[model samples]
Target: MDLTTRCLFLLSCLCMLLAIDLDAVEPSYYVDTSSTSDVIDYKDPCKAAAFLGDIALDEEDLRMFKVDRIVNVARQTVQTVNRTDPVTGSSTNEAGQSSVVPNRRGLRRWKRAATSRPERVWPEGVIPYVISGNFSGSQRAIFRQAMRHWEKHTCVTFIERTQEESYIVFTYRPCGCCSYVGRRGGGPQAISIGKNCDKFGIVVHELGHVIGFWHEHTRPDRDDHVSIIRDNIQQGQEYNFLKMEPGEVDSMGEVYDFDSIMHYARNTFSRGIFLDTILPRYDVNGVRPPIGQRTRLSKGDITQARKLYKCSRCGDSLQDSSGNFSSPGFPNGYSAYMHCIWRISVTPGEKIILNFTSMDLYRSHLCWYDHVEIRDGYWRKAPLKGRFCGDKVPEPIISTDSRLWIEFRSSSNWVGKGFSAVYEAICGGEVKRDNGQIQSPNYPDDYRPNKVCVWKITVAQGFHVGLTFQSFEIERHDSCAYDYLEVRDGNTENSPLLGRFCGYDKPDDIKTSSNQLWMKFVSDGSVNKAGFAANFFKEMDECSKPDNGRCEQRCVNTLGSYKCACDPGYELASDKRSCEAACGGFITKLNGSITSPGWPREYPPNKNCIWQLVAPTQYPHHPAVRRFRDRGQRCVQV
Candidate 1:
């Protein structure tokens, strides 16, 4: 036993005598492909740093940033990890909401609630939400996993209102996270999502300020790219760094995105560890992107949420900064029965290349006659990045999200020279997104020895493709046989089996009724771990396999029926199913707990139980004077 203890005793006797039976992977598990290293550039074109830095305005600094957005509207959660932003990839953990920005008012800015009152939107983008309190059962499966990250890339639609009059409550307070940047009418409104605001990018940045956006560094051209160091903030919160004012904001064109998941985290409200409130005006040769990356959204946040929820589309809608558009009167010939559409929008980690330079129209073979179609998102059911006519210059058509639609048909009799595409907005890796998160190779750490990865996740189309593993280390094997991780629901390679996961635990949710999900991550050139981090969102259609009466004791299906819930101390009874005793008559709230009744899971042959603890009777306790002693089985206390 030498040579590293005989390769650690032949990998612990080949992980307890092997196990790699995914319909027989034995061919000694091929597919090493030398490279499947899949990343497919899901466009995040980091050129971020778009001019806007150096601000400190007025209107009493916008009425002291709306009295500091109502003193950072609280409900209170307080996870408190501190170091709120020593910059260098900031650090925030207060989580119980307060969308973190108090480096002494570190300019969390994104103010828009007085555009003279009116711009609440969400009327058709549909957002009804609810949630209520005492949340648990893994916080309601983390509130449908932070609402499937805004139902996997916006077109909104949150549903579930019962007789709506103005919704969006999502409470579980001890407050802090905060919402209310938009639609703040009548009742329900709140948003809180307390205690570390339950991640998933702080519940999609407090539901993008309850679906109305604002805080992408408080726009108004964020001081030309970012550089707000007014003595590293904290001076009366310097009016939360005021700015916003050029028609206050519409940005549907997009650009100045320091990876905007709604930026604000340089050293947000700095004033410590050698202060530096928000720097980087340029200089990204070290390759950037990671300045508050709540993981998704940033294509200028789905291009200003598809221009603030007016998402119908056929043309006109672009952003950040770019120019040139043709096919309609471009140098000549282009009308007589036409159909033009141009949507360019960029900035959520950029992309949209297109550079046809010059062309003559009306071709054949595929263009069908008079064409120019490109789509990377929004309509034509996105994905076909090109469809040129009789052009010849069809190479650069980049965009994987951040919008690019572009369509220009014409055939009321030939239309030539009417083409010249030249669009810009790039960031690299050639990608096309449909919902993201894919890691394994060098993920979290350790992963890279004999590598081989493959990830194919498609979405949109009556959805269904869940996959959730947020983390899974490899190199172990009880049955995974050795460095496994095979998930395949369809997309070739004989698509079928949906499970294969390996050692280091973490592997349960694997859904795939179909919309594609084909992952593979083999590695065995000699052991290594830390490799796995799934997250494939979008799974709506299992309201308990079509029973959908809504809920009673247990029914959990969301995104329609507004995520019907109720199952933890039960309550939804109003003929909603059946479950009662909702604390108050001893349902004891303050965030759910207390079992023993039928818990640790069912018991008691003969029973009679009563429980009540409730907490805080004006806070007072401890006054033991005597003792108790029983002898049925000898119970004693003194």
Candidate 2:
């Protein structure tokens, strides 16, 4: 039991303590570079080594050797035992960690388990995050702003803390390398130039990935809806990892959303072989359902997360009867009704004014109704009341309940074409309709009239009626046919009728008459030519009134008198005698004044000036006054 026994017992106890120490320490995470027993081509060793170098160790001191005189000397022997690459005889050193080499097959198998597991969501506590690269205060401000926006919308809370209890941690390191974003075991981390990090939206985007969202462009079924050019995708590269394992399913049964905020900005192929690209394709144009830097968690993302981590108190139990999450309805709630007749109620004796802008005459229609009765037929014309061709038109006024119906029709060929209509109500008494030849004082000579008829009429109080108009047919020709009728009680001035009609026609005839109006007839001393044919009535051919042959020669009809013109040489005297000549040709002296040689100068003596004949050669040559002068001239004969 002396020296031999004591030494053996001490050795056993030391061996036990060493085994216990190894068991207590957590295994350091490492990437496996292994070769298979059966020969198979693999990633290049150098490339693998470079990728390994990219792996950043959180605890760098753990790999650094302590510089001490005694320990340094003792470590020299063990340090000389070089770990060489299996394929190359190169000694492995700290830099060799960046070298790519196949790992033993057994080691690769052990890593497979850890890599296959999906990342766990951060517990209900603060998450620790790290920021790589130097960041200025402004850059951090931007990052905080984005984080705040995310926090407000989502359940996650990001706290910047330096301790392990802190959910998120940030570290700044200046590396010429472009900023890269990724999630460590705890929270999201980013690397970039300080100023650039502040300016770029990459922080929010990377945080999205940290929260388990995928890239929008990498949606598995996205190709079905969007055509992605093969050249845009990286060859032999996986841009995103599936949230669930290859065949696993979440509670919602939804696959990962490529458009998820967590996805990489560029496609797998876009980064090139080195998993790096000088410039990312920021053109979101062709990307359907456009994805952008500020893009937040989509509905699918929220729904999945919510299902997985539901609120215990106010979870799915709350019934959303208001349809808060329902998709929006058609045409929006503001102007959904297109052609339905609307019953508008107004104060008694109130006048309604309907106005439209830039009337699309071809595709617009208007109709009026009162007390559920369809008053005026649907009218297809430019807006009557509003500015047209830079001219103002009188707005129609509705005074009675009978005039309640108003219709608007729009026929723009564009699928989503629409125009604005404004209505104003004027409250007074009944409206007045003047009968003294309703005319437009401001009518322009070159105005082309619209086909629709707009009338200004008065109505008594208690007037109510239905108003409606049909929608214009959609066709290649732009259709903008809509009608809005408003009735108001005010004395608005008459608007100009922009077109001309040659034949003697009355305004009432155009509005109430069932007769069809034809274009003006032109005569060149021969047969007359008819104007354009326009339908005036349901069953009428022409609108012109008929007269006998003698009436055509010049027959006048007065309320109390009638007359007919005689032959060219005949004339009528003051005594009402119809004869060949009223006075003889000889001259006569009257009251000391010389009379004309051809006729009798009758009546007051002062009324007749001394007359004489003047030759046509003495006519005034002044163009200005001559233009107004009569054909013949007489000289005074005193």
Candidate 3:
């Protein structure tokens, strides 16, 4: 097979043996770390396996197990020795001998510790805690299975217990362990479980120690700690209690038992240094049955736990209180101490004014955050600032639906020191309601009305008129209810009044008399007055009559007026106001006839004659008329 194929085969085999699905591997697995020769020839599968195994193993077991387990076992048996204080380089064995020799490789495996400090003090009561972690579903299931085992064996409850006595909080940091602490004032004890621990049984085990249960593996009478076989064991890597430092040892000072739930699982052939002969088991009959894939807690575990720590009677409690308050006058019949955050909603291109009022002694400041949603599943934040004073504030005009949230924070150090003080928030706009509905005021209270009311009336020359009344409502009134209406002609201000009508009483009704000359009305005490439509037509009739010699024809009087006419020799024009002559030329058709004594026998025909200009002596100058037969030329006249 090609080298790559062989390597793939070997990796696939290893994965199957470990019960891991290769498809589930992360990208980090594909990294090439070996030299070119190693990659080409598959020179060292053990080294490749070691690297792959380290990645595959749980973080807790990475440093504890050898990668090439088979190869390491086949080598000439090397006696296992326990290393205590890997940092200080100390070692101990079953013989109780100790030596200091540096384990150079062991130092590389230590992890960094957490350094962040808690900012706020934990409330002095039962605080609820939750778990955060990196365990897969299967891994969590396995952990739970282990937990059941511990619970069955130990009386301690891992999930729920009295709050004052204990609370379990879990987290996911790798290579972590659980611990419990009693508070300084004996308020409560807390149990913290690490997320990295693979075996849930470890939780019950560690909690057991916190409550004072001694490890069964460390039972002094059993002396199983030194009696167990340790052959072909990988030193400083796995399954050796002798490797524990002084701190890892229990405070109770008991001997160790290999079968203890606390004991590490190790290879059967492992034997310890300084043992003259490898002991198969500490006690032949003392061997507990091997825990099945589904190991559970035993009755002995619970009995032993209850003997150490007793349950407490207290329950859980916590405290949270913050901020300030105020009581202020509210507009619109509302009043209360409101600890409020302002929210603004407006349409595009709309401007709104916000007003606030408060009577609190402290200076107040307003701060707000603008929350805008740009698109699906996205958001952005903007800051909003507003004016503020001890009693009032107004927000600047805004033009978007971009919602605003406002908070009023007080600056007086004295306020909200021990307990929060109440404050009221009031918001008002130019908008208002009348009755139950929104409306604009008919007349703005701020407006001033003009004093004079003028009316222009037009009437034909002849017609009787009655009462004229104006229609309007009074929105607001002064103490005296009086106003005047004036009437005027179409001409300039100097024009004469055709007639005048006046009365002290406010008329209920005003009408003209039958003669059409005067106005009349009933008088009541009230001044529900209206202006004149009185005998105005009568005045126009008298003014329109022909005056003096202006009319040369007959005078015909019409209702409220009159017209003029002329005689037969004078014809009246269409205007009926002027006269004109009807005769064309002078009197040329005169025959031997004389009508008036002023008639001429042969008149100058073209001469225009005036009515009073004709003379009696003009025609008879020769006494022809008196003496013999028209002595003037042809004495004919028509």
Please tell me which model should have the higher TM-score, number 1 or number 3. 1
**Model 2 RMSD to the real structure?**
42.9
Q: What is the C-alpha lDDT profile of model 2 across 1-638, one tens digit per residue?
A: 23211211121111111111222222222111121111222111111111111112122111221111111111111122245433333244463221222222222111111121233345541244443223433344456545554544444545433344323333333321122212344323433322244443556654554444334433333343344444444432221211222222222346434444434433333535533321223334565343333456556555544443332222111111111110012222212223323223222223445443322222222322111111221111212322221112234433242123333332232232222334444333322421111111101011112222233443233221111111111111122122111122222322322223333221122321211111221112222211121111121111122642122233333211234332221233332323222111121111121112112322222122222122233332221111121123632211
| Model 1 per-residue lDDT at 484 | 90
Listing every candidate in turn, what is its Cα RMSD in Å to the true structure after a full C-alpha superposition? 25.0, 42.9, 48.4
Local distance difference test, each candidate? 0.53, 0.28, 0.28
Off by over 4 Å in 3: 1-129, 136-155, 159-168, 176-215, 221-231, 237-240, 243-259, 266-294, 311-638
lDDT value, residue 63 of candidate 2: 20
Error of 2 at 393 (Å): 64
* Model 1 lDDT tens row, 1-638: 22211111111111111111222211111111111112111111111111111111222223222221122122122232334323322243343322222233324233322222344665665676555435543444455445545654555655445456777766644424555555654655556566766777777776776676656666677677777887777643544555555554445445777877667777766667567677657756576545657777777777567656646443454443467777767877877567766666543334567788888887787778688788776555667866887757777776764457787777758657777666765432322244555655434346667656566667777777777664567877678776897887976558998788887677877777777777777787888976665546666664555555444434554322223444433345455455543211232233333332233334223323332323345533231323222223521121
Which candidate would rank higher by lDDT, 1 or 3?
Answer: 1
Order of the predicted models by TM-score, top scorer first: 2, 1, 3
Q: Identify the leading candidate in terms of lDDT.
A: 1
Best by TM-score: 2
In model 1, which regions exceed 4 Å deviation?
Answer: 1-175, 179-193, 196-205, 208-370, 375-387, 390-437, 440-470, 473-479, 482-531, 534-638
lDDT of 1: 0.53
